[model samples]
Each structure stands twice: as C-alpha cells, then as structure tokens.
Target: MKLQPNLLLRLGFRQNARLRHFTGVGTSLVYREYGDPQKVIVRREDVIPKLKDDQVLVRMLAAPVNPADINTVQGVYAVKPQLPSVPGNEGVGEVVEVGKNIESELQPGNYVIPRVNAFGTWRTHVVTTSSEIIKIPSDVDIAMAATIAVNPGTAYRMLKDFSPLNSGDTVIQNGANSAVGQAVIQIAATLGVKTINVVRDRPAISVLKEHLTKLGATVVVTENELRKSEEVKSLPQPKLALNCVSGQSGTEILRKLSPHGVMVTYGGMSRQPVTVPVGAFIFNNVTLRGFWMTHWNKEHFSHPKRHQMLNELFQLAKTGGLQPPNHSLVPFSDYHIALKNAMPREGMLCKKQILIF
Candidate 1:
C-alpha cells in the first residue's frame, strides 16, 4: 500500500498513544507536610499514570533510608521539596515497560537508578522520563547498586578532586566508621593511598578497628587515641583530611595536616561548625573546603566526569573492591522499622536500613 508520509506519521503516533494507555496502581510512601519522617510519611496505593512517549515504567527493587532523607523530611536539609512528596533519594529498579517513542537505550528488564535527587524512590513503581535515570549493570548486586550513587561517589570525588594523591600518600579523616568513611578507606586503598581512619571510642572499639582494617584502612584509631598515639605520629602527615564529624574532632584532624594540606568537610555529624585555627591558615597554608553531594550532582549532572566516576564505582562493586556497608534489609511493609532504625539514637551504632519490595 502506497501511503503518504504524513499519513504514516499519524498512524505511528496513534499506535504509540495506544501503548501509553496502560495503567495500574502501585504503593508509595507520601508526605503532605514536612515533619518527623515517621509521623508525616504515610503509605498509599496510588494509580500509576499511563506512560508518556518518552518515559519508562520502573518496578522498584529496593531503596535505603539515608540520614539525608530523614533531614529532608524534617525540613532541615539545605534543599527542600514541595509538600506531598516522596522521600527516597536513590535506589535501583527494573524497567518493566517502555514508551514506544523512547530514544534512549533503556528497555524492558534493564536495571536503572535515578541520576538526580528527590526521585521519591520509596515506592513500588515509578514512571520517569528516560533522561532522568541511567542504566546500571544488571549483574551488580542490587543493594550495592542502590547505594553506589551517593556515599561511594562522595568518596571517589573527594579523593580525585581535592588533591593529586600518589601511591603511599596519606589521608586522615574522622567518622571512620561511617558508610562514606568506609568507602574512603577502600577507595583510597585501591589507589594505593594510606588512610588513617578516626572514630569515636566505643565499647566495641576493637571489633570496629579490626573491621575497618580488613576493609583496607591503614590505621584506625579512637578519637582519644588519635591525639596521643605514637603510631599515628610516625606516619607522614596527611596531605588531605576529611571531616564529617565537625567540632573538636574536626579540629584534631585539622591539626594533623601536612604543609599545604586541604581539609574538605562533607558532613557535620556533630552538628557543630568546623573551627579552623588561625595558625593553620597563616603558617601551614592549609585550605578548608566543604562538599555537599546534592550540590555536586546539580553542578555536574551532564558532565562526563560524573558518569565516568559512576562507571568506575560500578566496576569496583562488581570486582568486590567496594562493598556495601553494614545494612539490614527490612520488608517494604515494615517501613516503620526501617525509619526507626535509620534515626540516630544516643550511644547506639545503627546499621543502614534498606526497604525491600
């Protein structure tokens, strides 16, 4: 049949429109107002809208409850979302359907993760534009893939961007037992950089030190030990210091820097300001900087370096060079448990909580 080009185009559009008509309902955790995450966020089964020509329907596999997610819900994070929002910032999912006009490489059954924040990943399904998500290796561990975008990416960027580190170069950091801290130790080790990890002294300090050591930390010391330990003093002064626990701990890390060193503060677990000594800025020529992963993502959303870093992290996860931190998987139905476990409790070490569908 000889058809006009315009008629052919119209027919194609109709077929694609028919494909977009399919719809279903899915579970989501929604919040109408910012408050306590556990208080305001509630579960609801909402109708999943029909797919648009450029969108894909993803069936979520798992998502983690991060501290930032809690802060966002509490209206304390630097960036805020409009009310009646979903909470998760990152997760991994499978593409169950694709709109007929999607031009990207995404396809049914491909694994993907949101490339940006505020994705509202704490849901059973989502219909997102193909451009908003990026495909991940289907073979990688789902839990590791779910977490790869943030903590490990933070570790990777901090090491590569802040300094020109060579093999045997030393880096010092507090919050050594944190997820990001663990990532720092492993990534630094892979680059042949030595890390002097610092953590608060706890009842099970030995176990914690041994665990970090096995993950490639060159040295793990309690906050008190960091000040007086001769072993730490024997190592070359670190050219870089990572501060997540700002306050007295941050000050101590600053005191240990080498000449012309840089200290990059990425977190304030202590909720205190990073106080730099006058002598450090004047005498040693050290620089103090801050990093927010969310801000970094906004700046580098389309930069090649962002994807390059992600690919490297994926390879590390596949090869076992990078491992997901201590975590406990809670069923999606037990979201309350996940929320409760994710909250900070005095004197208790909390394992990351992942909600599995």
Candidate 2:
C-alpha cells in the first residue's frame, strides 16, 4: 500500500514543488567555544530541518540576545549543551507549516514563542513540537513579543511564587537595571504593589532614580543607602526580595526584609555567593530560595500552564500595564553587527537589543 499525503506530512514533510526537486535546508548560528563573538560560526543553508509527527515549522521572526543566551554559549550556565550546538534559547516565530498528524492548538500564521533547549533559534526556521510553542496575542508587536520568554517569564514566576503580594506591600530587589528587574517593577506596579529597588551608585544617580521611579518603583536606593537607610525601618518591611546579585549585596537585601519574609535568588550576575547572616535564619524566620527558569519550566509547570502564563502576560502588555523597555532592532542580515553590539556593556544607552528577522 502507498503512503498517503497525510502520512507523508506526519513524517516531517510539506507538499512544496521543491520537495520533489530539491533538498530543504535551514541556516543557523553555532558556537563551539566560550570566548568572544568572533568565535561564533554562522552556518547558512546548512540543512532544512524536518518536523516530526507531532512537530510544527516556525519561521523565525525575532529573538533577543539575553545575558543567559550569551552565557549558554560561554558554557557558564548550568544547562550547557554539547559543543558546536545552535545557540538561541528563546525566540518568536510564525507557524508556516504543520505535520499532518500534528494536532496543535497553534495555527499557521499565528505568532508563537518557544523555549526549546539547545535547538538553535538563530536560524531562518525551527522545527519543534506543539508542546514547546506558546501562542502570542495578535496585537503584540513581533519585535517586543520576541522578548517575552525568559526575562519576563522569570520576573512573573518569581513575584508570584516568593510571596502573596498585596496592595501597598513592597518588594526589594537588586540588579534593578536588569530586564527582569524592570519587568518586576512594572508588573508589581500594575498589581498595586510597591518596589524598593537597589542599584550600584552611578554618576547620574538622580537620572537613574527618576527612570526607575517612572517605572513604578516606590523607592530607588544605591547600595550604600540600602545599608544605612534608617528610612526603611519606617516603611513597610519588605515581605519579598529578589536577588540576582549575590555576596554582600544579597545579605544586605535579606537584612531589610520583614520577619518570616522570603528572598528568592535567581542569577549570580555579581559572580558572588549570597551570604546570609546567621541571625536572619534563626531569629527573623527568613527563608532563602533559588529560582532557575529552566528548572521551573521543565519541572514545576506543565506545557499548558506555560501557554496560559504567556497569554496572561500578553493581556497585561495589551492593556499598557506591562510594557517592554526600549529596544534596538537589528535585521537578520545584519546579524553579525547585532552580535557584536550585544556584548556586555557597562553604561546605560539601549536597554535591550533584539534581532529582527
């Protein structure tokens, strides 16, 4: 018996005329080592990836160059893959085709974002299962939509999990300049919660404070002020604190929390271990926990929950409550320039840079 067209599609295929005349190939960015951007290898038109029976084809739209994405390439993240692997962790794409037997809640032309592990997204397209893709709202801009996966997802999960936030309650966090930190400030504001943000003292402290305050932060304190703030005693003691910078910075955040409050640590961007005072654990009843986006996505939440969470985020974005920060857009053809521009920088200029395909 001959295989049906449906069966052929199910086995990773489409009915293009080229399917009969030529081989399909996809181009991707691959990195083999931990070093500078020059170390990255751009392999174009390598192989046109085929979808499995349960998978769909996503035409790449836009993807951001996040710190974690860079870290993965550097082999610093906990989830390092084998050498010469594709390098993007999150991206937004449109479903161009679906396998015949694929039963996806997602449809072609719909914008979808996915957090697939080590399956390089710095490509013209990606082939992944329906389980990995989250349908995005129609109104969300595809460029801003590209940033929805890791940073925003981390901020949302941490705020929701660390403690129950109420109106007028305040949360403290370091790395207030990070993308996730900014999202936390905005989301907390939208929820009627307040934020006490901490950052290193820069030359333009006033300007930085104003920027954060505009983002809904109740208070913006330098690291030095955080330690000496007799003012914090009068304010509502923070019930939740987020620490991406570790070491003494983390300890200072813990010191400011209310009794029995929790501090959730996500990243160690400071390259320091969080040091906690013995008194915080023994007397204050404080709990210290860690959050890793990969761990939470893989173990705690199911695929459906991930989709639902993103849907809620989109609703917030559409309402103008959870707006994304200013972004620099680079075309896919200029990916080399974009890659160079994405290097770790010290000063403030562009907050987030996204690669537009």
Candidate 3:
C-alpha cells in the first residue's frame, strides 16, 4: 500500500522538531582540585567523554544535590574520583543515544536514573553502560526520579537485609526525619510493620510529629523526649534500630530495642561513635551492623535484580507515597546559584534540593 508522507506530521506532531543535544565539544562541571565547598575548583569546557559500546548518552533532565554529592566534590567522601573528573553522584535523564548491543534494554527517549557513586551525573550529559542506568517510569515525577537513586534504594535494602521483620514488628531509627528515615517509615508501613522514629529537636515539634506520623511513623520523639520520657520507656521495644546519628544519640536508639535486636548503622551524620552498653551486645544479644549503599549495591544484587528494584521504587513514587521534601528546583543555567543555596539547613527547610534543567 502506498503511504501518505504528511499523514504522520498531521497527527499532532511537528515534522522538523529539534531536540537540544550536548557533546564533549564544550566543558561541563569538572573538578581539578578539592578544597572548600565554595572553592573546590570546578571548570566548564568542552571535552569529549569516551563511551563504551554497551553505554548510552543521556541528556540530564534533573539532578539532586545530595550531601554525599557535595562531600565528594569537597574530597571528603569515602569514594573519591580522579582529579579533573566530573563530580555528581546521582541524576535522572532521557536516553538520547544507545549503543548497538544494548538496544533491547535501552533506547532513545527512555527516562532513567543513574546509580549513585557513578559521579558526573550533574552534567549536561552522562555516558554510561546500559546496565548502570535504571529505566524509570516515564510518568513518574522527574524531580522525584532525580532524588530516588540513593535514599529510597538504601532504605529498601536496609529494611530487607537487616533481619526479617514481619507485620506488627517494630523498628526504631534515630534521624528518622532524614530522607532515608522517611522512606523507611512509609515502606515499613506499606508492609504493615510499625516504626518508632527519633529526630533531633526542630523548631516546630508538633508539625514535625504530624508529618512523620502521616508517613506511618507510630511514634516520633525528639532526642530530649527520648532521653527522659517515661511513656517511651513503657512502649514496646523495637526489633531493629536504624541509626544515622552516632555517639550518645545512637546509643540511645539502642536502648529502645528489644533483646536480640539488630541495629544497622547506615550513616554517621553526628560525627560521634555509636556507643552501646557492653551488655546490650554481650548480654542482650544486640547486633550492630554497618551498611554502605555502594558496597551493598556492588556485592549483593545482580544486574537484573537491581533493575527490578528500581522499577518497584518508581512504582512507589508514582503513588505519591515515597517522596523527598522538595526544597527547590533550579534550572541548568542557574546551577551556580543553586549550588550556593544547597548548604545544609535546619528543620523542614533542610529538605532535598533538586537541580532541574
């Protein structure tokens, strides 16, 4: 049958549509040396990034400025990239070009989120293996997708890995107001498990409680409340404790767990050691385990499983159940100003900040 050439163009589409493309022709953000957050050198210029045959080129749509990302740029993070390297840890993008072999797995126009620690996600484009970019649901919020790769994934893994907690089981975590903590609360709630959340005192305690409670936290207490509340002492002990705050604050989280409970420490934001009573480990059979998202992502999951996990996370995001408290969305042009405002803040004001092109 003979086809009419203009037929497709007439079906609500423009025939000569142009998509903005990026190449190594000019510089994106790169660090020559690490110093201060404000002064850690970054240069913008054009230099072609080599791509593997199994890789794809992504036009970055949006990226979040995570604490880890900032730390890496400051050269204080655990995993440091080579000098003069790009320094973004996570971002969402649309695949613009795909290599031959990965054609079945990825294609142009697919939305994806790159794995955390695969730095350079902050650029106008990222070249990465097909296996590294997790295809996200297109209808999912780009801002949410940009922030999902790390906190939500980490929380999912920690809950599943750190011991089996069935419905009705209780878990406690300090720093429960953190992104991961909020995710943990909602995910656990969806699984029918309960959460006891602990947070540092913020300006508006009642408002904070309402927020976490709505996210399915059964109990939300300030550190001070946790330290002295007789009501909390009478409550049922948690089977697991997730600690991000360290030092004495973390130890207090341990005190709320039942005997034989496991405490998984994923972050040490407090810069203090997690001190537990010697008896908690020796007599109570409490276990303290460490979890690093990078190490777990590397050692535990297969490529296919990792991809499936990402799909599940996006499904959660689609329902509006999983989300970071969005602080702001900055365009690619205002990246400098956005980066400047990305400092650690307090209360709800300290929520996640996403950089959107």
Candidate 4:
C-alpha cells in the first residue's frame, strides 16, 4: 500500500486533540542579533514548519537557562549559530506528532532530547528529525532529563577519560558548586571515589559547602582555604583535576594534584587562562587537556558507548544517586527573567533558572 502523509497527520490530530495539532502556532525566545542575552532575547510566535517524512514535532517541556546558552547568545561561545536563531541549547521535550514516514523508533508522546549541541531549544515547540533527537525515558524526572546533555554528561566523561581512577581514588575540581561540579561529587560518591571540591570564598560559602558535603564531597573548601588549610593537606592527593574556572582558582586546584595527575579544562568561568607552576608539570609530570561536550558529542554520537553512558546516568537519576541542579522556573512568557538570572552577578552563585513551556 502507498503511504499517505495527510491521512497520517490527520489521524494523529484525531489521536491528540490539542489545538496546536492543526495550527502549529507556538512561542519561542529568538535573537536576531547576538550580544547580551538580557537585551536581545524576545518572545515570538509563529506557525511551525511542516514536518518532513523523517521529522517529528515536539512540545518543549522545560529548557535549562544554562551559562552556555547565555554565552552562545553573546556570540562568545566556541560554537555560534547562524543569525536570527532560536536561543536554547538543551532541554527535555515530548514527541507530539511524528511524520508519516518516520521510523517506529519515534512515536507521539515519547520523550526526547537534542542529539547535538546547537539544536536551539528555547521554545514552546520544535520540529526536528529522528536524526536530530534521541529518545529518553518518558517517566524520568523532568528537570533531570532536561539537563543531562551538557553538565552531567561532562562530569561523566571527564571522570572516565582522565586519570585511571578506581574505588577509593580521589579527584579534585574547581567550581565545586557548579552543576557539573555537583555531578562530579555525586557520581564519584556512587562509584566509591572521593572528591575535593574547591570554590571561591563568598558570604554564602558555608551554606554552599554544607550543600556540596551532603552531595558527597569529601572536602569542600574555598580557594583561600585550600591554599592554607592543614586539614586539606592531610587527604590523599588527587589524580585528576577538573577545571571550569581557569585563573588562579584553577592554579590552586592544579597545584594540589598528585604526581602524574591529569587536569582537564572544560570551561573558563573566570575568563582567566589556566596557569600552573613549572615544577608541577616538570616534576609532577602533570598533563593538561580540554573537553568540550559539543565536540565530544559530534565525535561520539553514534558510538555504542554513548548510549551506555546515558543508560548509566539514567539509572543513577532513577535511583536517586544523581539529582538535578537547583533551579527556579519561569514560564516561557517570562524568559527575560530566566535570561537575567543566568548572567554573572555579585552576591553568591545561585541556582539556574529554567524555562517552562
């Protein structure tokens, strides 16, 4: 029998009685020009394009207001989108309608996440292909599912790729309170590895330390404290260092690594280049490398291990071994508030804000 596109969509419309099923009008946060996100992001609504035989229509559930999303909007990120682009990088979405000829692997009501880094997600709906998205467990926690791409995925890869660590082994990282850093702590805890998390001193230092400690950080200390404390000096030297804040903060963490240690640079929050003493590299034989989740995904998207890694992470999330980052919600209409919260500011590091459709 010949396939029929109109009838397939017509039947899908009958199955799901939502109004958008027909009109395809949906909202989005768009930026025609790149700069500061707070000034450029605006709300727009339009009819979603018709789906190709391989495409699927998805209703965005929740999209994270990630720092990378802000950086991308500023035109400073390593990866930049074409002009007049939609502005979010990661989120969980529900499959609302599938193209008539789409593979049975994707179906209406299934959950999915973007398959690539720059698949803009700050919208109420998305029209994408089976090749552009990967199915996720429908019952997974929304917040956790929305954020699994960049942050936790980074932590998981760094932990596995760097130094050869085993049960009872130790790793240290700067930006201890960051989403990725917390994932490091929790993942290490689950694997019987220890984490020494270093954060900058702030008024809320004690509270942050307490929170990270509860997440299984073996030791949480300020940059200043890490440099001066005898207590920190007593623990087993770390074989791996994860640096998100490059600057003296990264140097402080790098200086604490054990001989033959490896430091992986994944982000530069402090906007300062990583600096280390010559002796540490020469005598300690320390190695430096960098990891960008974007690049990794491009290289490994079809690798069998990619799914294995995600399965492990999903298991952790389902079992409560891994938790989502602390975050506040903003309805899609109030995206400006989420954008503003994502910017760097005084006071102390705070929870990320997410856009709820």
Deviation in Å, model 2, residue 263 alpha carbon: 0.9
Relative to the true structure, how large is the alpha-carbon lDDT of every model? Answer: 0.88, 0.78, 0.76, 0.85
Across residues 266-356, which tens digit of lDDT does each residue of candidate 2 receive? 9887798889999999999999999988888887445677777788788888887777766788877677777777777664534566777
- Candidate 2 segments whose C-alpha is farther than 4 A from its true place: 1-25, 49-53, 229-234, 300-304, 347-350
lDDT of 1: 0.88
Q: What is the lDDT of residue 217 in candidate 2?
A: 86
The order by descending TM-score is: 1, 4, 2, 3
Per-residue alpha-carbon lDDT of candidate 3 for residues 222-261, written as tens digits (9 for 90 to 100): 8888867765665577898899988888998898889999
Clash pairs detected, candidate 4:
none
130-184: candidate 1 lDDT, tens digit per residue? 8889888898887898888989999999999998999989999999888899999
Q: What TM-scores do the predictions have? A: 0.93, 0.88, 0.87, 0.93
TM-score of 1: 0.93
Candidate number with the higher lDDT (2 or 4)? 4
Q: Which runs in model 4 stand beyond 4 Å of their true positions?
A: 1-21
State the lDDT of candidate 4 residue by residue for 50-115, as single tens digits.
677777888788899898888888998887789899988899888877878888888877889998
Clashes of each: 0, 4, 6, 0
Candidate 3 colliding pairs, count? 6
